[model samples]
Target chain A: MIQNLTTVWRFRHFLLALVRLDLRLRYRRSILGVGWSLLNPIAMTIVFALVFSKILGGDDLTRYVPHLLIGLAVWGFLKESATAGSRAFLQSESYIRQSPLPLGIYPLRVVLGQAIHSTIAIAVAVVVTLVYQPYQPEPTDPLAILSIVPGLILMFLVAWSAATIFAFVNVYFQDTQHLLEVAAQLLFFLTPIIYTAGKLVGKAWWWLELNPVQIILELIRTPLMKGHPPTADRLLAGLYLAVVMITLAAGTAAWLRKRVIFHL
Target chain B: MAKIALTDVSLTFTVHQRKRVTLKEYLIQTVVHRRSISTAVSVHALAGVNLSLRDGDRLGVIGHNGAGKSTLLKLLAGIYPPTVGTREVEGKICSLFDISLGFEPEATGWDNISYRAFLQGESPASLRGKMDGIAAFTELGSFLDVPVRHYSAGMMMRLAFSIATAIEPEVLLIDEVLAVGDMAFQEKAQARMKEMMGSARIMVLVAHDLKTIRKMCNRAIWMQQGRVMGAGPTDEVVDAYIASVTRTAAA
Candidate 1:
């Protein structure tokens, strides 16, 4: 494990270059360029706010817009990373066949690339929060900035591990790419993105507890949306999930690293 | 010193007949019959291949298509581990099986160069000085500024070959990549390869052109059906391989 980390660190520039390549290729020849990253979530949030505010029968636009924006941005990050990272290996099959670099870098490249877009979306969310401060839930504590540190770290760790696992599985089982697409759509509605988790009162709330995404989402949403650090329970949940995902990612890579080249 | 040694190395590829099976189909198949939905066929790509190389060995590999020539190079390059035997390699190996393997067409030639080098484990800090030399070698001066998508196939191959050969590797495994560019550039590339071979501790060249192999390699191995048929001086192996091919043709 230490050796793997060191190898990845040595090739950090490679990872950064791949991420830059991904971002550049994604928006290449487009007039808006990377502006699309910020525009996408903003557009989604507007549509969701319009539809959900009417369904919930609420005129409080500011309160729900920020909530929906932040949640959607986080969800978008997870969805893109998971889907893109799963195909990272297949996409770089040529490089894998020719180069001798560590195989793990492909998944890292996908996560980092999506992380950049996610960061842009989060920045837009912060701007929305400030603009709609009067109507939205005001941040209660300045210490919330500190909470974002662990929050962002945990968020990235979970996404990275999940992407790595998906990348490995997708190599052998090409169905994983399509499976993740459907799963991401299902997970979006299931997670408390469009609606607030607080609305579910009784046994239904336990459903949220069962979702690992809920804890990962709260890691960011609690500090960013609620203006406070995540509860100790949420933090512990994120930590536990991170441990399990990281172990699984490492185990899968070790077990399948040699064989993945053949599948590719 | 660069070295590679394989003791009874073998590789098998377990290919699934149906690569993509939906989750629903898989689950139903598993729950209903407790069996896999897709059948897997295992192909023995390489079998009981034993070889050893040390410093100053310019080894040539000649074989018919699908005879595991590329697999041997991949095993030496660390792209694939031996399925059965023990394999050990000590070197900063560079394998050039496909020159245009990693080029992002939407990226500029400058970026592609850096990207390819980085994939070969070359750090940006270390590659900065070498970039100019590589660009000069490609002769794609102003063209390097534009995206690689606009470059012609030969132009792209030039860029790829230049970047791939920028650094003198401790061990170099090449697969018929020397037949690149126009005649002038091919001669230049051959000269550059010779210079690289002079510095490289070990070199493995896999090519179908017997004359090229005999010219460049001191020793050669002929593979037939995933096993080494003959191994010895390049001239002897080439002569025997050619004799057998022509004899079969005459028959």
Candidate 2:
């Protein structure tokens, strides 16, 4: 596994080139360019804040806006990585056939692209939180900024692992992407994205901690929405999940590395 | 020093005959029909082949269709892992296989050049020195600024051939004769290929044209159905291969 990672690192320039090519091709054609990527989450945040604020009771832009924006951004990266990464190998079939590029770089290329788009959305969320405080909430805590660095690192790891697994799995079964789409939709509702986790307090509240994505989301969302860093339990839980996912990703790569070219 | 040693190496390819059935179709087919259809076709592309090459050896591979000539070149290039046995190769391997197929249509000719060079293991720092030479070889001129999607098939072939041949490899693997682009460009490409082969420490080429193989290679192997049927001095192997063909024809 370490050797596999070294191989990928050796081809880091090629991986970066692939990511650059994807980003360039994506934005070069449209006049709106990156504004299009920003538009979807921004528009979705506004719509969700308006509708969900009523359901959760009262006009709480401070709480709802940041929660909705950050939640949507995180979910967007996670979902896009899996969906797009499902075909990452197939997409690079030409390169795969020609040279011995580490297959992991294909999903890394996709995950990096989605992460960039999501990071932009997260930046928007942070900006809105600072600029649009509806309550007497002074979240000028520098620790919130420091805390997010770790959270972003953890988020990237999870996204990379998921994308790697999906890329390999989809090579064997084309239905993996379709199934992931359905699972994403189901998980979107199951995980409290638009809805608040505080609402589920006192009944099955442990479920939130049990779900590491929810924990990672809280690690990301707490400072923006609640003006404080996430609790220690949430940080540990997120770390544990990241490690688990990375191990799974490593295992998948080891098992599928030699055989995937045949499948392709 | 460039060296390649294969000890009873074999490669098997499992090709999926059809798209794998989803869970729904699979259940209906297995549970309801009480029989499952085999979906994979296993091809023994290479079987227990052993060979060695030292520095300055130019080996040519000749084979009929489905006889694994391209597969052997790819195997040497490390594109496909041997299913069994051991392959010990010490060198930087540069391969020219399907070189024209991997370019990004949305990218400009210059962008394609860099990326293709990158794929061939050329760092940007190294590519800087070779960039002008590659571009000049293409003769695309102002077309390098334009997206490759706009270029003609012949133009794309020129760009691909130019970028692919830019590298100075320790071990070179060529799949078939790369006679690409228009007649003028083809001659230039042929000359460049000859130059690349001459400069490389060791080279393995796969080609159907026996005359070209005999001219270019010092040693040769004749492959048929994934095994080496004949191997030796180029002249002897070519004579044996030709004799086999003619004898079969007479029979």
DockQ of 2: 0.62
For this target, which candidate reaches the highest TM-score against the unseen true structure? 2
Let me know the DockQ for model 1.
Answer: 0.55
Residue B125, model 2, lDDT:
95
* DockQ for every prediction shown: 0.55, 0.62
| Most lDDT-accurate candidate | 2
Clashing pairs in 1: none
lDDT of 2 by residue, A151-261 (tens): 888988998999999998888777888999999998898787878786666876778868656867888877666566777877888899999999999889888788988
Reference contacts reproduced by model 1: 0.62
The interface root-mean-square deviations, each candidate in sequence, come to 2.0, 1.7
Give candidate 2's whole-model lDDT: 0.85
lDDT of all predictions, in order shown?
0.84, 0.85
